[model samples]
Target: MRPVPKQRRGVTPRARLRVLQLPVVLWLTLVWVALWGELSAANVVFGLVVSIVVCLVFPLPTLPMDLHIRPLRLVWLVLRFLGDVVVASVEVAWITLRFWREPRNAVIEVDLETSSDFVLTVVAEMVSLVPGSLVVEARRSTHTLFLHVLDARDTAGVDKMRSQVYALERRVVRALGTETQRLPEGGTP
Candidate 1:
C-alpha cells in the first residue's frame, strides 16, 4: 500500500499575518454592538443575519502586510492624522476668508525623498484635503508634487510650500511607510 501526500496551501503563516497587519479598531467593531439592542428571538435572529449579510456584501479590502502592524505606530498615525485635519481645516478656512487683491496663485513643485508610492499618496491626499491648496498633479516617476496654492508672494512662498511637502512626506513615512535604503543614493528630494 502507498501513502498519498496531502495538498499544501501556498499561504505562509507569516505572510498571512502580514496581509492583515492593521486592525480596523473599535470604530468598525462598534457595528457589532448595534445588534445588542432590542433583542427578542426574531430580532436577534434578524440582527445576526443582517450583520452576516452586511459584512459579506461589503468586506474590507484585504491588504498585504495589513496584519503585521505595530500598535504604537498605528496609534501615533491616527493621532497625527486627526491633528493634521484640524490644523489644515483651520488654515484653509482662514485662507478662504481673506480678501486679497492680486491673488498671485502659483503651482508649487515638491520633490519627494521616499521611494514608497503609498507614503507619497498619503502626503498628496493630506495636502489636497486643505482648502487653499490643491495637488494639481503628482508625477510619481519623478517624485514631484505640483500644487496650486491660493496665493503666492514670490519664490520664497513657493519654496516654503515645497518644504511643507517634504516635511509631509517624512511624516507619512513615519506613519505608514517602511524606509527603503536607496542604492547609489545621490539624488535630490
Candidate 2:
C-alpha cells in the first residue's frame, strides 16, 4: 500500500466558501439590494450572486480571534450602545453649533486592561462610531488606543474623556471577555 500525502496548511478548495461568513454575505446582498432600490426576485438572486462573487474574488484578511458570546450581556451592551449613540449625536451636534469658532480638539491615549487584540479592535470601532472621538492609533504591544477627541477644552476635560473611554472598555470587557481576561469586581486593574 502507498503512503498518503500530508494535507496542506492553507485553505482547501471546499473551504473557500467557508472563508466568507454567512452574516457578511447576507449583509453584502442586502446592501446590493438597497443600492438598487428594488425588491424583485431577480434583484435578490443577482445580489446574492454578486455578493458571493465579490467575496470569492476578493478574500478578506483573516483575524485569528477568540470570541466568547454572552447573550444577556450582549443584549445589554447593544441597548447601552444605542442609547450612547443617541446621546452622543445630540451632544456632538450641540458642541458643533456652540463652538464652531474654537473647538477644543485633543489626542488622548488610553491604556486598555485587556491584552486581547479582538477586544482592542471592538473597543476602537465602538469609540470611533460614537461621533466625537476617532481612533488615531492602536498599539498592540502596549494595549493602548490613541483617539482624537473633539470639544475637550482643558486638562480636566481630557481626563474626563479618558475616564469615559476606560469605562467603555470596562463595559466591553464585561460584555464579551472571558473570566481570565476580564477586570476584577473592585476594578483596580
Candidate 3:
C-alpha cells in the first residue's frame, strides 16, 4: 500500500483561490440580478453560474489586501455620498439650464493620500458616480486621479473640488481602510 501524504495545515491553495474569488463572483452575481431588475431563485442561480464561468474564463490577479470594515463609518459614507449626489444633481441641472453661458469645466489632478489601489478605485468610482464630475484618468504609480469637474471656473472652485475629493477619500479610508492605514491629519468632515 502507498503511504498517504500528510495533509497541509491552514488554508490549501484551492481554498485560498476560492476565498479570493468570492468577492468578484458575488459582485458579478449581484450586478446580474440588478440588471434583470428582479430577484428570483432562478435568476440568482443562473447569475451565480454565469459569474463563476466568467471568473474561470478571465481570472483576476489577487492582491494582498488588509481590509477592515467599520459598519457605522460605511453607513455614514453612503449617506454622505447620497447627499452629494442630490446636491450635484441640482448643480448640474442648473448648469444645463443656463443656456446663455458655457459651463466652465476643468480637469484637475488630485493626489490622494492613501496609496492603496482599492481605496483609489473606490474613490474614483464614487467621484465618477456624482453628476458634476468624472474620473478621466487614474495614475497608479503616483496614486493620482484626474477628474473633469463641471463649473470649476476659478481657482477657488478648483480648490473646493480638490478638497471635496480629499474629504471623500477620507471617508472611504475611514470606512474600509486597512488596519495600519492612518487618516490624514485633519478631522473628518
Candidate 4:
C-alpha cells in the first residue's frame, strides 16, 4: 500500500479574483438603491430584500489569490490610475490625429517587473483599453509584453510607451500587493 502525498497549502487556482469583490459589491449596492429609488420606509424594505436576493443569486467564486490591499494606499493608487488614464487618453487622441496625417507604427516589448500574474493581467488590460496602444502579446514566463503603438518613430517613442506601462504596473502593485523587496536608501541595489 502506498502512502498518500500531501498537497502544499497556499492560494488555490480558484481563489485569485478578490479584485472583483469590491466592484461587485458596489454594483449590488447601486442596484439596490436604484430599485428602491429615494429613501423611504417602503423603499428601504424593498432595497434590503433585493440586496439579500442578489447576494445569494450571484455569489463570487474564489480565485485562489489574495489581494493584500492597504486601504489608503489603494485609494491613492486608484486616483493615480485614473489620472494616468485621462492623460493617456489625451495623448492617444493626439497620436491618432498624427497617425491620420502620417501613419507609422511599431511593436515594442515592455518588461514587467511584477511577479504577480493578477497585477500583470490588470496592467495589460488597462494598457489595452487605452486607444493609442494595444498589448499585442504577454509572455508570462518572460514577464514581457509586446505592445503595438501608433505613430511611434524612434527609441524615445518606445520609451514613452514603456514609461506608461511601468506607471500602470506601479499603481497595480501599490493597490493590490505588498512590496516584497526594498531598494537601497539612495540608489538601486
Candidate 5:
C-alpha cells in the first residue's frame, strides 16, 4: 500500500519568511544606513534591529497578492516606463516654455481593468511619475483614479488621456499582476 503523505502543522518556513516581508525589511534597513550616512558592521546590525522593531510595531498591510515575477516582462516594463518619463519631461518643458498658449487642465477619471489593489497602486504611482499628469484621487473600492491632466482641452483630449492611463495600467498588469488579471478580448496582460 502506498504511504499517506504526512500532514503539516502550523506555518511552514516559507510562510514565516513571508510574514517578515524580507524586501520591505531590507529596504528599511538600507534607508536607515543612508540616513546615518555611514556603513559599518555595527551600523548594519543596528539598522537591522531597528528595521525589525519598526516592522513588528507597524506591520505591512496584507493585500490580496499573488506575485509571479516575470523577469523579462519586468525589464521591458522598466525600459518602457523610462522612455515615457523622458518624453513626458520634454513635453512638459515645452508646455512651460510656451506660456502664451495656456494649457487646459482637467481632472480625468480612469477605471483600471483590474481590481487588485497592488496593480492599482502601481498604476497610480507610475502615472504620477510621468509628467503632464498626477493622480489627484484614488478610489480603491471602485478601482478608479482621478488624474489632474495638463492640456486636456477637449473631449478628444480627455479620451486620449484615458487611453494613455489604460495603456499604462495594462503594462503594469503584464509586468507583475497575476494570470487572472488578463486584459479583455483575449489580450494577455
Candidate 6:
C-alpha cells in the first residue's frame, strides 16, 4: 500500500478560492456602485454581498492575464482617445446638421496586429465610443473589427477609416498588451 500525501497547513482550499476570486469580486462591486450612482457604507456592503453571490453562482474560468500596462503609453492612449472623441463628436454634429445631404457611409474591416483579447476588446470599445464610427462586429478568431463609418465617400475614405482603426489598435496594444504583443515604435509587430 502507498502512503498518502499530507495537505499543507494554514492555507485551505476555500481560502485559496477566495484569493482567486478577490479581483473579480472587487471589480463587480465597483461596477455595482457605479450603476447605482452613489457610494455609501450600506451600498458598499450590499454590493460586496451581491458580488460575492454572483461570483459563487456563476464562476468564471480563469484565464492567464496578458495585460502589461505602460503608464506613459496609457496616458498617451487616453489623451488620443479624448481628442478622437471630441473631433468625431464635432464631425458627427456637422453631419447631422446637414440633413439636406445624405452622408455616405461604409462598413470597413480592420485586421488588428495584436492577438490579445483584452486589447481587442478595449480597441473595439474605444472605437465604438467615438461618435462617427461604430464597431458592428468583432471576430476574435481573426482579431478583426468591422466598423460602420460615417462620411466614408470613397475608397480613400475607407482606407483612412481602416488606418485609423489600426492606429487605435496600436495605441491600445502599446498601453496594455504583453511585451510580445507590442509592436516596435514606428513599426508593425
lDDT of 1 by residue, 1-189 (tens): 224333235746664444332244232334444546553666545655565555444544343332234567667756766786787678766766776755678987787886655666777887887556798898877767789987667888888777776655655555453663432243232
Provide the lDDT at 104 for model 3.
88
Clashes of 2: 0
Each candidate structure's TM-score, on Cα atoms with residue i matched to residue i, is 0.55, 0.71, 0.78, 0.60, 0.80, 0.78
Spell out the clash pairs found in candidate 5. none
Q: Name the regions of candidate 4 deviating beyond 4 angstroms.
A: 1-62, 98-100, 182-189
TM-score of 1: 0.55
lDDT score for candidate 6 against the true structure: 0.81
lDDT pick, better of 3 and 4: 3
Clashing pairs in 3: none
Residue range 85-145, candidate 4, lDDT tens digits:
7887897778666645775788998888766667777888878877678888988776788
lDDT on C-alpha atoms for all candidate structures: 0.62, 0.81, 0.85, 0.68, 0.82, 0.81
True lDDT of residue 67, candidate 4: 74
| C-alpha lDDT of candidate 1 relative to the true structure | 0.62
lDDT tens readout by residue for model 2, 89-149:
9989988788446888999989987777777888899999998899999887778999999
Model 5 Cα RMSD, 1 decimal: 8.4
Q: Which ten residues in a row have the lowest lDDT in candidate 3?
A: 1-10
* Candidate 5 residue-wise lDDT at 10: 68
* TM-score between candidate 4 and the true structure: 0.60
Candidate 5 lDDT, 13-44, residue by residue in tens? 66545557777789999999999999988888
